[model samples]
Target: MLFDLHEAAANRVSTTQRRNTTTGASAASAMASSLTASRANGLGGLDTAFTSTEDLNCKENLEQDLGDDNSNDLLLSCPHFRNEIGGEYERNVSFSRASAGSPGGSECRLAEPALSTYRTNASISVLEVPKEQQRTQSRPRQYSIEHVDLGARYYQDYFVGKEHASYFGVDEKLGPVAVSIKREKLEDHKDHGPQYQYRIIFRTHELITLRGSILEDATPTAMKHGTGRGLPLKDALEYVIPELNIHCLRLALNTPKVTEQLLKLDEQGLSRKHKVGILYCRAGQSSEEEMYNNEEAGPAFEEFLSLLGEKVCLRGFTKYAAQLDVKTDSTGTHSLYTTYQDYEIMFHVSTLLPYTPNNRQQLLRKRHIGNDIVTIIFQEPGALPFTPKNIRSHFQHVFIIVRAHNPCTDNVCYRQLLSGQTLPCPHCVPEHVPSHCSSHWRNDLLMWLLPH
Candidate 1:
């Protein structure tokens, strides 16, 4: 079969050369005749007989040399023959190869000419591959729950419940103050890190009053009332506490003045000087526009504040409703204030700074943020990841980083939520102090505060 194919291919090539020579000779003869014609008359008697005779001789020679049995093989083996034969022969050849149940098998066995011709001449159309099939890459699997280190199960596991509250000591004014600690798992923090809502309760029975009962009877009663005139007992008793180290907690409890100041601040509210700074890092165009127009951060920023502020029961409430108090100005220097458990927190937002035409650093903004003891850094999605080294502040000992997670339905988020894994790439901070780190799905945001 191979020998016959080769012989047929050679004959077809010779026939093509002869046909070209004959056509050239016919063109030469026609040109000679037209040139020799009379100047008065155009070459109306141009001879096409030579071309017709050469074509007929070429076809007869091809038929005689290449029989019907080898004609198909010659067409298949020679690309020149296939081109001359027309697209119909190419389509039939492709169909035969495809029907053989192995499209690649014919390609492997064919010579270079046959393969090249098959590719160039084949009219086979293919539908585009679906997007799902094109996507071969997948995200890495998240860490398993067993690999996560959730802190000590709960805060209660650290010490006995209210039973051993006497170990802390008695308050001079409140008298025999009892301390109780309770831990609550923050819904958002469950997947990100070890962040829990901790509450410290201080109870004293020395101030409670009883009707027509002895002082001893009142002494044995539950410590519900307070003798202090300023803040109510119930209000002062249970205080929502941040994630603090054991040493810090010990220092606060041992020092009577610190405890007193904490209670007073909780009652009277924090002063303007004692405010949490709101710094903007890599704020995208959308957030910058919002800030320029309304002197307020974008939805991601508002969502972050809602986590710390009072939760209101309302449908489709604005970001400001029952949340942060905004003091807007024409100069873009707006002030944000919010109360957490009656404790005032004034936020110095960076975006609210006076517009500086050429100042990219915004020194004025940094100065305010730098002086603040605690600062919250709001970062927009797709922006550069924020790091503590980006800012130089002597007094800013604590940094609360809030990152917006756009398109929260990503596989990484789902896998992390399922496996209870920490962030894939956690931000690095120098002089690292472990604090509560959490992810809020409400606005698709991740937040973590580090205190040095």
Candidate 2:
């Protein structure tokens, strides 16, 4: 199962992660070499060379109640999209055809145990643009690598696209907020002795940490987590914010059908098994070679907002899954987390939807799954697919189809990049697409979505 240098580079894992420390800097160097070679051969998707064009046209203060949260202003608009936030739509929903020939298809294992308190999606709306890039022409994409005096490095990749997925946790003070991965930096923190902070940096540049007692390996023997007061981070943010950044709302207006579906998903209610959308972690590097070798170095791209895709096997798409234990209560609270690699990848329920391709053939081409390029499916929990299924399909049936990406909102981030507002990866977008998806896309996904 040999992969191309470009594809492999497009999905590179973190070389500096402490877990990889055993392999040391040499392995990192090898990865760099591979990335360099791949870039030379041409392959920088979202990670390398990708930048947001919206930054140039957008204004500075997007959260100042300019006009309306759903404002249709060119520069300032609502960013709230209509994905999986609707109520449960199990009303006779079933797949048109059974998994008669679906290769990766399997029985439905997801079942709702109880929901004393749960969140379909966050309802908050706050996004702002950066001032520096407003005055100048678009600049080259780059990363912020800060070197502290403590012989440690804190690097944040800035050149990524639409934050399709997000991490969430509860704050002792602010209740709950979005979280960003701190990576394996146990020794870097001087005050806290080897602890990871699930923190969210708002558009206001406020770093809020969702406080909770940390547990290791999330073992069966670990102490139970305490249920705190008020709404969980996701709900709290949703409660405070009334609308999406106006930018997203305007984009949704243009795509009424998808917007309608998003509203439907939301009304139906969102769950791990029946999510309306899926997130991808784009993997690549920002290098001149990457820029030169790749034609998609520009910002129009939005797919795979890089993180750790290798860590995502086929959870919703296949029998292989990552366990996400959920516990909710009537006190407007819920807790969800997944234990992986001797650590828990915690999460708060939210909403998402991705139309990676307008048509099936295009999807195959983008993933390089054609004749010479065979996309091998591994049952391993961490070996996820390039394009994953949004919801868990049951043995009897499943419903819903892919929603086309909204061009108006695809490349643009909710706010400014510096404000921690990331854009969605908009790759595989048709240069001159029709007003909506073509007939082939809707006729039936069985041809492409299901295995032969």
Highest lDDT, which number? 1
lDDT tens digits, residue span 302-376, model 2: 221111122232233232222232122211122222322223232211111111223422221222111111111
Q: Across residues 1-452, which tens digit of lDDT does each residue of candidate 1 receive? A: 00122233344456555653322112222323333442213345544443445344444433221111111211111101111111111112233333323232321121212322232211212222334445332211221111111121212233233221212344433333334443333344445443333334332332211011012112223542232232222222222211111221222243455445434422331132246666554444322222223333566555545554443322332443212233333324345555432234555666555555566556556555556655665555544433232344435544444445542323211101100011212222211121222433321222122111
Candidate 1 wrongly placed segments (more than 4 Å): 1-274, 283-333, 407-452
Instruction: Provide the overall lDDT of each model, using Cα atoms, as 2-decimal numbers.
Output: 0.33, 0.22
Residue-level error in angstroms, candidate 1, position 112:
70
Clashing pairs in 1: none
Model 1 poorest ten-residue lDDT run:
412-421
Clashes of 1: 0
lDDT of 1 at 164: 18
